[model samples]
Target: MEVLGTIISVIGLIVHIIQKVNQSSHGDTNTTYYTDTTYAVVHKFTPQEKLDNMNIDSLNICYKTAGISGFSIEKARRTLLNSYVQHDFYIDDVIIRQNCMYIKVMHAIPFNGGNKCYGASFSMNFMTVNDGVAVYGSKKINADEELVFKEIANELIKAVS
Candidate 1:
């Protein structure tokens, strides 16, 4: 019961290219997702707001680029959103919350199936969305290929805790 399974979409190798659209230039709708500053996690995203056009559009672009079928970003959106809204203790940062969402998607492969492309795109976008966090200048978080699934899950838990 202690070890919930963990899945990772390692970003190093992937086939699909996430159409590199400038998120900030997309107008007001996606601006929230591209904000360079961090925000405090203050509220639960409603079921509706969770799959807001911003995330859906981004995820859709990824899926489309990957040539994936049968997977619904809408469904993935709900599942990832639940990771935050339904959390037990508390996750404090909006950035971490965002990472939590992508990580869950990568790990769970909740869609009909997931690919290296999805994982790469989601994590890359998550990092970019949060001021390019832990992604540059020695602040990057590396994945330990040596870690067991349970250990990885614990690390993820500690990350958002």
Candidate 2:
């Protein structure tokens, strides 16, 4: 009887430890709050066999106003288009607004035998009555390339506000 009890206790302890480890690895259960509004940002790379047979990666930012359900796609598009044009980014397309959302798509082209690359980015900005502005930006890039996504996001935020 005593041996059986010891085995059961050891098993229980092991199960408890495993559960704790799993929870910790998945992040704390505590909630996190951001003073500034949060946005869903995505960066993706796609191989373009037609254009120089190179890869094109796009970075996108989706903005939502506080208390608003859907992302302001049109506002984001306008903001991005204006900024890109002012900065002389390659303007392949204008801001697109549809289905109560704004989308901007741009691409980067490689040159100098793939030694150099250039790209454009687009964003849509939404002005909130009280909370300020929200923006979504997207840009395409070549494979194995790195760009300042965060810096651009910050700049967009500043420009619209």
Candidate 3:
């Protein structure tokens, strides 16, 4: 009778462990999501053959602006939309909001048959007191575009400075 009771207790313990594991495994199944609005602009410089003749580096600039408001989702969204419109960039897509505080900008520039290039991508949190924009290039960028990037950087610097 003692041996039989011990065996029954061991079986009960095993069953309890299995039940706890199963419950934990199935407890949280909801997928987490993130939201961001993407703005993109593409300019074709030359024909495939002409571009093939020249060397190119992909250039990209990403910057963040803050201080418009505290690090709130609503404020971030509003600032992002306003900035996109002010910059005159085309909005490609907007993702649903997640439980985070930040806005991001991504840029991609391709050259020379899209063979070789460099790019930049970054994000800014809403709590930031200053904003920043950057310019990245493979070899070099056009004087005009470079100037524009500088202007953007200056703007960001001013916001932060």
Candidate 4:
């Protein structure tokens, strides 16, 4: 009876230590609060996704946002602007904070009414993480959107590196 009790206690202690290690590794989801907006950011990746550069989940896209080994916010901003202009996208707005930058891009098309316009907008955010950066954005999850994202991300990596 005494031996059985000791074995059970050891197993419990091992389980608790494993749980703690997993918790520390994954950590908590990061929350970003701006003056007018808030976002809950999490990284969800599969093993296969890590091996493929162009493949991403349907809901959203995220990248390590690394340049060489580190990241430079200023260089990222310039690359973003250059891509924005190259793609003929209008700038809705850009907000640069201490550790993050938000860029909104817009595309406008003429409506049937002479004075009215139809437009679509999307936003991309870059935030400093661990030793590099995390770049994430939302999209409609279509082929065209994915292509555009890849183009921009490639440009950013090339420029910063």
Which one is best on lDDT?
4
Model 2 spans > 4 angstroms off = 1-92, 96-129, 137-147
lDDT of each: 0.31, 0.43, 0.39, 0.50
**Which one wins by TM-score: 3 or 4?**
4
Q: Where in model 3 is the C-alpha error above 4 Å?
A: 28-85, 89-140, 147-161
C-alpha-based local distance difference test score of model 1: 0.31
Residue runs of model 4 more than 4 Å from their true location after superposition: 1-60, 78-92, 107-130
TM-score of 2: 0.28
Over the stretch 9-49, how does candidate 4's per-residue lDDT look in tens digits? 99999999998888778864563435856777677554334
lDDT for residue 66 in candidate 1, whole number 0-100: 22
lDDT of 2 by residue, 49-77 (tens): 22222111332444322333443555545
Q: Model 1 compared with the native: what TM-score?
A: 0.18
Candidate 3 local accuracy as lDDT? 0.39
Give candidate 3's error at residue 56 in angstroms: 26
Model 4 — TM-score against the truth? 0.38
Model 3, span 17-100: residue lDDT tens: 997888677763564556777866676434343223322223234332334433444544454555544232222322222432
Candidate of highest TM-score:
4
lDDT of 1 by residue, 79-158 (tens): 44456432222222222244324332232222222332222212213233322212111111333221222332333333
